[model samples]
Target chain A: MVTISCRDLDVDLGGRRVLSAIDLDFAAGALVGVIGPNGAGKSTLARAMLNLVPTAGGSVAIDGAELVGLAPSHVARRVAYLPQGQEIHWPLSVERLVGLGRLPHLAPFSRIGPVDQAAIESAMAQTGTLPLRERIATELSGGERARVMLARALATEAPALIVDEPLASLDPGHQIEVMALLAARARAGGLVLVILHDLAAAARYCDRLVLLHHGRVVGDGAAGDVLSDAALDAVYGISAWRGEAEGAPLFVPLRRRD
Target chain B: MSLLLPLLLMFALLSGLLSIAVGPAHIGLPAMVAAIEGKGDPIVRAILLDLRLPRAILGLVVGAMLGAGGAALQGYLRNPLAEPAILGISSTAALGAVIAIYFKLADTYSWLVPLFAVIGAVLALIPLLALSARGESALTLILAGVALSTLAGAGISLALNLAPNPFAAMEITSWLLGSLEDRSFKDVLIAAPCVAIGLALLLGQGRALDALSLGEDGARSLGTDLRRTRLQMLAGIAIGVGGAVAVSGAIGFVGLIVPHLVRPLTDRSPSAVLLPSAVAGALLLTTADIAVRLVPTAMPLKLGVLTALVGVPFFVRHLLRERRLW
Candidate 1:
């Protein structure tokens, strides 16, 4: 099983403290949602964990080895990251865009082999983007572009996947489909951490939740426990109506606390 | 894309042969073939081997350098408008060559002009790249390039103003206007190594450029060493463009125009566009050089002037079409 742990991590960007004294552990076989209000350092935390951003203090480790010491390609083989924005500069075809994920696995001059091709095909299939394989990526709909980006990340086939705001431009159907896909990946023995803004989706889909406020973790536990009215009101500054729907937790934010 | 490479190569080869054959001292195919095989008249052999061959070769090399360099810069910067001359690399190189001319260093040593030009190109690149390394946008880079180009243009004017004699000033003026006229094999020898090295460096970066298409964050997560990629790209442009300017002065627009024309044909892959753009660049410049020979002006037309005449309109059209980019 794969595990990622951060100990008292601190990050400062442009002389501003973005994340401070944060500690967390992520394990395979679970879908964890990182939900927080704007500027709560959710993206910073993810970037810091991946070593994409410099940490001011403390350490992040993957399987007991410090992440900072690992080669970037080695780190890439273990963790896949999907950034928030869906920016595709060139109008590359979907297949070509998705094929870029195999870069870390192949040599610079090497052509895609059988295993790489299979992984790319499988990732596209999982994201339901195989039908759009021949279409231009930049010309796709917002939701389709998001799916293509997700497929690019999934094509990495890394043990752990960290996705930031994957549902931002996706429709309701795509949102549910993507959520289910993440849950299934976790169930299949991969660690999946998703940053989400939709409280209801987080409550229904994630096995666990990590709630942030002022760059600190205010809540971390099972979804139902972390989505308590008090925790929600304090961290998110909103009072939420919480209940169960078909044995699944449901959360609805009704009013601002102030 | 598969067919485009061969077609471009064939076009470059045909254009190069046509350029050699179309010069003032025209030699037919039979004589040209005999000249190559060392059985032609001494005058015919000298005209083909000593005069036209180097000019044609320089045209091809210089064009290839500008085109490939422009494509690589565009790919690296993620902006379609990026080109060597616009980025101030070529002007800085010209400034170096002009300074050499002013000091009579070029008169004494044929190689010093290109060497100093390469140095100047590399120096200009340092500031431009430093701005980009700070994560500046494309607009900032273009603005910086414009500033550098303006400053270099002034420096060239100053050199002209301070020229020791009228003849010296005229020589510097015409050189600044840019030309491939009267160049010899010595000029080709000077530029070939630098161009070869620069092309190698840039072409090796295809995979990295592809990764960079996803933006810096995406590229980093995909295991692309962006710092290294940026360094290689800057160095490649400096050496390649500096060498070309060292020999042929500042031939503009080939870099900017050829890549845009060939990009769609290459499936829009930045890596895929490099070789074909190089070929297209060679073809365009050689054809332009032939146009220079045929234009029948009182004095020979400047290669750089012809390119600017063609390129400036294309650039204006691009800006008007992509007005939203600004």
Candidate 2:
């Protein structure tokens, strides 16, 4: 079982504390959505957990080992990350682009062998991007690019995947499909931590929700408990529709609260 | 993919042979063979061993360093317009060599010039490394490179303006034209080691550069030590390109144009682009050197001038036509 935990983590950027007293734990076989309003430091929190940002206090641990000072390759072997709003700089084919995910596993100067090829192919298949293998990645449409990026992350086959804002700029249909892919990944025993903006989608699909406001964790737990009417009204300054639809718990944000 | 390198290598080899064959000497193939056996005519022996061979080898080595250096710089900065000459790196090395000449240090010690050139290259690379680390835009990096190039040019111009004597000034001015004329085996010995180290360093970075196409953060996330990669690339470009400039003045635009000409053949993968660029660089330079020989002029065209003539136009076209590619 995989376990990622942050205990009272604090992060300072440019002499300003971006996150403070943030404590979070992620376990295997769960999709956890991190939700927050603007400037809530959600991205900062994710970066901290990945050891991308320096911690001012406390520690992050993956499987009981401190993440700070850990080799990036060691972290990559266990946790795959898909950063937000990525831009490809080359016109590499989709096949080669996703194949780069196997770098941490291969030795220097070595070619990708059959095992790596299999993993790359499977990742493309899983994300429905196999057909785009020959296409230049920089020329793809937005939805296709998102899927290709997801495929690249999946090719790592790491136990835990942390993605920031994967749904941004995607249309509704593509959004649901991507969400389903993440949900399936979690169900298949991967720990998936995603930063999401759609509260209803987070409520409907995630096993838990984390709410951050101004670098503080204001709410955490089941979506129903964390995204309550009072919680939404107090934190977001808005009233949201909360009910059940087709036996799945549903939530839709409405007008602002006074 | 496999055949591409061999093809370029063959082309470079032919260029080298052409460089050796087409000089102002009348050494036949039989005499060339006898010369290798040390029994040919003394004039033919001097022509082969002293004049043409070193020039051909220098052309090959300098060309490869430039080509590979350009491709590597482009990969590191993620900008197609990035090259040692256009970015002023070679000028810095040339400036270092000029300082050695201006101070007359080369008369005291022959090795001091390339050493100073390497030092000059590494010193100038500091601002570039810091700027790239800040993850600036392509345009910003290019602008900064242009500024550095301009500053280096001004420094060179100032040195030319204040020579100790007319002869000293002539020596300095001619060297800046970037020719491989009248070079000897000693010059080859001086340039080879630095180029070898730099080339090895450059070629080893293919995998890291491939990963870096994802950007610094993405490459870092994939377990690449961004700091180490940058340091290695910096050392490679400085030592190799700097050494090239030290021995043969400033041959501009070989690095700039070679990689662009080669990128389409390699699917634009930065890693795959480097070696072919090196080979193509050698081919282009050796060919240009040959052209320098054939051009009908009072004084034959300088290698630097021809490459700049071709490169500046191509660079402008690249800016206009392919802004979206990078």
Candidate 3:
């Protein structure tokens, strides 16, 4: 188990501040959904945690170890990231693509061992991508490709998983399926932070919701507490109709705020 | 894919052997075998051991370098069209060789031309890397390469214009056409170390290149050091292609064509394409060299000329087939 903590994190991109003075802590065994309107720096926050983007100030650490000071391979062993764009440049088979997740674990010249193979198989099985292992990744449907990419991330078996916009191209069924998989991963003692645009799904599946507007966290806590009507209107510029369905929380954007 | 690698290696070996056998002074297989055993006629032995063998070896080495360099560049840039020549390294090296020839340096020092050419190749990478360091896209990189190539082409033309005599000018022109003819073991020795170092660097990057196929951010997330990878790739291409151009002049398209032809056979994995592409490149150049010898032209056709003739058409066809990508 790992705890990812960020203190006053700031990021600047091309002279524009994308994220500013952000502080958060992600404990293991929770599915945290980062939700915001477009251009709220959701992707930037995720990238900043991984040190993929240059941080202007402040510190992000995993279990009190500075993330920026660690070697990329070391950080990768602790945190696995699934970028927003699902880019597979080559026509590599699904199995080979997922096997890339084993990179940080394997030595430079060593082949994939039995333990690595088991992790890869388990990841594929969990993501329902085992059946498409031999198929070319580039040829897959958007939903299937997203699952394959998710499997690639899961194959890392890192303590912290940061996924951005995972439900963008997925259908309704696949979206819930992916959300359930992420929730299950958290239940199984992994820290899963996913960025979701769908508020309903975000509330339904995530144990905690981080609502951001223009790079600052406006709401963060349990799903019900964070998705309050006033908070939704203030941050999202919309009113949401909240109700309970089958003992699970449900939220639908009702109208744009005047 | 496993079978393809061995087959390509076998074909490259056969082509190299054929190149050694089919020169103007035909040392038949029996005589060649005797020469190998150190028991052939002195004349046949001298011709086979001194002339044809070095030329064949040079062709094989230069071809392999370009091919592997091409694959490595393509994989790093994540663009199928990326090659040694695309980034202006070859032309810059050619310019260096031409300047050496124009200054009569080639006459005074046999090694001066290749030495300058290697310097030129390494120098050309400076701007290419500087542009990429600013986080330029692939299109920007290609555009920068075009500008650099044009600048180097102008430099070559200036060197040609400043030649001491028409005969010197003519010599520079033909040399620019690129050939493996009359190369000695000395030439082989000169280029081998740099090419070997470059190939080792490129080959070691297989796993990193595989990670990069997921795009830059994805690769970074997977623990790839993009900056380090970029540096290694730039240095590898510069050293490898520089060494090749130093010896063989400007051989075009071998780098571009070989990788594409062999990619499918390698399951389209950029890392997996490297070795096979190198083998296929050696085979292509060796065959082209043999054809140059056998075609019975009044003047021997240049290897670069033949490759362009074949490669340009195939490239056009590829563009047409993948037109939607643009």
Best by DockQ: 2
What interface RMSD does candidate 1 have? Answer: 2.5
TM-score of chain B of 2: 0.89
Rank order (by DockQ, best first):
2, 3, 1
- Residue-by-residue lDDT tens digits, candidate 1, B142-255: 777789889999999999999989999998988877788888988998788889988999999988888888887888888887777877877888888899999998777889
Candidate 2 regions with alpha-carbon error over 4 angstroms: B86-88, B106-112, B125-151, B313-326
- Candidate by candidate, in order, the iRMS in Å equals 2.5, 1.3, 2.1
The DockQ value obtained for model 2 is 0.73
- Of 1 and 2, the candidate ranking higher by DockQ: 2
TM-score of each candidate structure, all chains considered together = 0.95, 0.94, 0.96
The per-model lDDT (C-alpha) reads 0.89, 0.85, 0.89
Query: Which of the two candidates, 1 or 3, achieves a greater TM-score against the reference?
Result: 3
- Colliding residue pairs in candidate 1: none
lDDT string for model 2 (A184-221, tens) is: 99999999999998998899889989999889999999
Candidate 3 local accuracy as lDDT? 0.89
